[model samples]
Target: MDSKNRAKWACFGEIFEAVAQQGIDELDAVEALLAALRNGLRAYGYRRQFTFNESGKVERLPRDIYPQPVPVAIWRDSGTPKGDLTSIWQDDPEEPEVWISIDWVSGAVESLDWELTNFEHLRTDFSAIRIPRKEADHLLSDLAGRPKKRAGRPLGPSSPWEKEQVAAALRMIDGGDTRPATAIATGLTDTALIGKALESQQRRLTWGIKTALTGNAKNSANNKRD
Candidate 1:
């Protein structure tokens, strides 16, 4: 066997061994294998297709449609035709075609096939796959809302009010309140401040400072009662 085929079978063997170790039934085994294959294809930028028959006409349905008709066959494709260069079809002369025929009622994979030719195209460089412009923009927008890490020593509570705020936030957190709720109670709108309060609370517990503070509070209360 060629190196490519050998590698493919070896990977399949590993998946089979893992599924066998779980001691599942035949149906479960088939489902697990299907899931693994679908996930692997998605990771390589393959898009799914749902084929449906309506009134004697076959149609491709979008993923979000409700009451999804069981697909006669599942198809995944990736190539420059769709502005994606993440699949083997990027080098193929014809359009991409990879599909798995399914028996939905019996929950069995009927057949699996793909279009390929033996023309010596260079091996795919997955790391160098170019992202579509729209996807790249979306990723950038998502990252814009996240906090950026700063270099050098981390900053702590800079003022007495800030220290008190952190303490109040920590108390709310200890009461099992979520960060958003704690933020509202403590008037801490900045998520970074909420994070700092959690860190401070952890440090106090680690250093036994919480115990000391509790003891001091109890002694003050006793003195007042005296």
Candidate 2:
């Protein structure tokens, strides 16, 4: 090869190497964060908790279910340091971790993860309460129960982005924030679904979806109970 062509190929190899290294770095970072989250959960006596169906319905987690109360949090959002936290990354792998901004709370019997974010603390602040064992037992009873569902309607794994959009629509509805003028203002194409979501109180589209988005992140111990 000519000297000029040889040099061009060398530079191309270097650029390609850099890109590959960056992808490796991103994957390593994601894996490390997931490991740390699971480690903390183990330390706090928390288990896999629950798994969501394809449609996002909640189901028991079987053996990995927490034997006792354990403070936990999940990925909420990205781009802010508030209870409304956000993560900004585009490295989506085949089985990407949801990468929740979870923190180990200090003390409290049980509080809705969403409610905990509303404390006077900054969006970046972490707060947890210590709960007495006896009190925690009573408080944690019925913390997770099977959602009301129709027979023979099953959901399976779905694309994460698709789940997020569908869940977002449901959340907007559950909050009773259905305003028809919203479609007129935003010009979203799926106005019909949005309209039904606002007018209908469908649990399958509501709780089912949220469960699927934030379902059990750990699969090291796979145990499903029907």
For each of the candidates, the C-alpha root-mean-square deviation to the true structure, in angstroms, is 20.1, 28.5
Best by lDDT: 1
Candidate 2 has a TM-score of 0.17
The residue-by-residue lDDT of candidate 1 on 1-226, one tens digit each, is 4666433322222333443454534344434334433444321221233332345423234433221222222323321111121122322346523323332222222222432453221211111112233332332333334354458432444446455655666676568766553233335433454577656534433233234346667998888953
TM-score of each: 0.22, 0.17
Model 2 agreement with the true structure over 1-226: per-residue lDDT tens digits? 4666433221212322333444533233323333433344222323333333466635343544323434334322321223212233212436433323432222112111222343321112222312233322222221222254458533421335434555565566568856542342233223455564433323333444445434533342355455
Which residues of candidate 1, in runs, are more than 4 Å off?
A: 1-10, 39-164, 167-200, 204-226
Alpha-carbon local distance difference test for all models:
0.36, 0.34
* Candidate 1 CA-lDDT value: 0.36
Residue pairs clashing in model 1 are: none
